[model samples]
Target: MSVTVIRPADRAAWLDARRQDVTASVAAAVLNVHPYTSQYQLWAEKTGRLSPDGEATDAMMRGVYIEPVGVAMLRDQKPEWAVEYHADNAYYRDEKIRIGATPDAFAVDPGREGRGNVQIKSASESAFKDYWIDPDTKQVIPPTWIALQAITEARLTGCDWACVALVVITWRGTLRLYVIDIPLIERHWVAIKTGVAEFWRVVDAGEHPPIDWEKDGSTVLDVYRDSYTDVRDLSDDAALDVIIRRYKEAKELESSGKKLADTLKPQIIFALGNSAAGKTASYDIRASTQIRASYVASESQSRVLRIKPRRDHDVDASRF
Candidate 1:
């Protein structure tokens, strides 16, 4: 499969190129499966409506420094395979669908005509134990978002398979390597293309996707940061009416719960006045103090939604 190779001269070039096409990194966003980026946020960024703050994240920095180590460790662990590392900034794009990928490394099986691509990731010990491995099944599965990224990269690179080359960094200053091979699902590619097509269609038509309330709340707030001194009568919105009612009820419960907890904490502390630890019928409580690092928070204003009642109603929506 012949694809276009883009060797970026600098990070700016790479970012610019990434914005032009649906790269493998943000492919999961198109499918609404990515945890970090929502479809709305991706659209906002791609459409130049929202410009991401030009700051490199800690994970991004870690990957930049640990990627070579990850690929090297993978080579050492898989002795039978030939690992090939390419230019870090080389992006391969398929013109057919305008989908592109920047692979971490490529793996070749020696004495065989088979090749696969590797997606390198640096995971903390806790993250590996909690998320990388299935709690119930005890099977290790990389994040679906990253797995999709690897699959898309493999397909774009003309490879047979894709695998996640994970580098688990422990707090004990020890490292662990796991190369989990991902089986190819042909339908996944089809779904990816379909999702990407829909995204591009909306982009061309200047349409915004419906808000993913769960994942896109922060994105919406960030993209539309300005808050004007305006009030509108949203009483006609039945959905918002119910939502606000639930929110108020929940807030009341939270206030009462906090009061109860605060009252109990003093009683428990008094009971444990003479002792540092106390045991109840089903609970063991201990009193302890730890020093915390203090730092000044950055100055920024976040939008707050406040609902004021226009009229009093005795009707209970929750009961209905």
Candidate 2:
């Protein structure tokens, strides 16, 4: 059986149209490439669950913040002749090759100044930490993936120069931009292409390739874990007892069905004070909640002391 491979130029044009459609849409959109299509098919085969579009849609919607930044960077930086490319599908010699990559955002740099691609990622503070590390030396690494993707798009499009622009937006409303040069990416082209070829070979042989982060676990999950410290210093049995107590309390509250605000009364206290000759003054203290007691004894006198829970240090609002 003969196989048909679509010319790269034709593929590029089709991909450009699809990306434009996505940009124009009001809702988040997704455009899947080749190996993903094949992988989805295999997943369906194994799991007997045929709905891949829903999964893809959910994933795409989760990262919609990156789209606007990517689009803006492409329009501002790239050339007029450059077009977006996506790999839609691919097949073996006995089947047609169908692969697509919409280059997230891409454009040719007019006057051959610089062709550029943008890989916009909305990263939390902790996720950005990994990008700042050196991947090889495990030191502070830069955004190499963005550069590699940009160079791949440049080579695929035959552009003179390529740049990878990363727009990382944090949850706290801060945006960080990172740019990578094309030549640095070009140096790794051979390795990248070889890896792709090997990947396809595995796919063509009808074996299910592992998921992108299956080995190490999901990157998003890792980020979520990194956001907070573990409060699990207590043993499992003790933790379960606490959890069970909370559950029982919740159940009792649910049964009563009382308004939450009505059930709990909050008290507020106020104090007025003035400085007098810069002398320190003492006030009466009360014991409440779990607290530690201390004793101070001198040869002439003895005193009993109680310590309250240490509050978080007061912070100046101006720093933020």
Candidate 3:
């Protein structure tokens, strides 16, 4: 279904429009596998069980400051493509599913074939280094999670394509900018929007979606952290009894594991002496170190010992 676009002036209006709808930022979470925020966390927030983003991180503040810079750089570098800033967030609604999105900004080209949206991102020096790609080539690769968000915005806006402007802060505090063009894929948007629709349905029903135990376990634990405000003894439920037993066993196993590791750590370190590596028939252990600048110490060096199986070794997997 086509989306309805709204340009609301007030912040409250924009926020109200976003309520109960799947916005671009959490679109990845709806489908799971967002790099940072978990789907369960998003679910909790939407269901009004938890309030998140109460305190913005340092990175968030940095993004706020760098957003204008991104907009300015794009306009200066590409004069033909006029970039217009939205004073308030733009809202889009798919009436069928009640899903919506807001892009960072929109491109104002009088003669363009289809509408275009813009996304601005900022990262720290280390992160930028890890994700850096050559923007000059058509082969420029966007970060997966953020790309999903930008594409979701494009889908809501009925745009054929979108542009992402990435800005990074260097170690010396200088800003670097890269621009990438992303074309919309119908199949991807269909899957994302459909998944989001179902997710919102779960929220409206006051129920949780199917949980990926390994992925959502920590979120579930946090959600129930204060579930029992006061402890009281009661008749035992069979499930609770089994859980208590397992918990005791887990604690014992953890203590044993730590003790064993501690006992062996000194012996291994001492045996290494001045050697950086040790080799066995089936395994190799290496000591690696690095020096880097630190905010508190000015400079620091750290070392770690890593162990791995020999490249050609065929170890028995079932012997654990």
Best prediction by lDDT: 1
Which pairs clash in model 3? none
Q: Estimate each model's TM-score.
A: 0.73, 0.39, 0.68
**Model 3 agreement with the true structure over 1-320: per-residue lDDT tens digits:** 67888888776677668876777877887777577666677786676654333445787677778888999988887788878786466688887787778777888666667668889988777876566554565354777777888888887777767878888778998877788877677787887877887887777787777655445544543343232122222212333333333333444577665444433433333334335555444445554444588788656443344555558755443432
What lDDT would each prediction earn against the true structure?
0.72, 0.37, 0.65
Off by over 4 Å in 3: 2-16, 108-112, 132-139, 213-218, 228-243, 252-320
> Whose TM-score is greatest here?
1
Per-residue lDDT for 316 in model 1?
A: 52
What CA RMSD would you report for each candidate? Answer: 12.7, 22.2, 14.0
> Considering only N, C-alpha and C atoms within 3 Å, which residue pairs clash in candidate 1?
none
Which lDDT tens digits does candidate 1 get at residues 1-320? 46888899998888877777788988998888888887888887888866355678888999998999998898788889989996568888877677898898988877556898888999999999988999889888898998889888988988987889899999897899988988779999888888988988998998887765555555554554443333333334454444444545555678665444333333333333324343332233344332244467544543333334444444454543
* Model 2 Cα shift for residue 20 (angstroms): 21
Report the Cα lDDT for candidate 3. 0.65
What's the best-to-worst order under lDDT?
1, 3, 2
Clash count list over all predictions: 0, 20, 0
Q: Residue 25's C-alpha lDDT in candidate 3? A: 77
Q: Rank the candidates by TM-score, best first.
A: 1, 3, 2
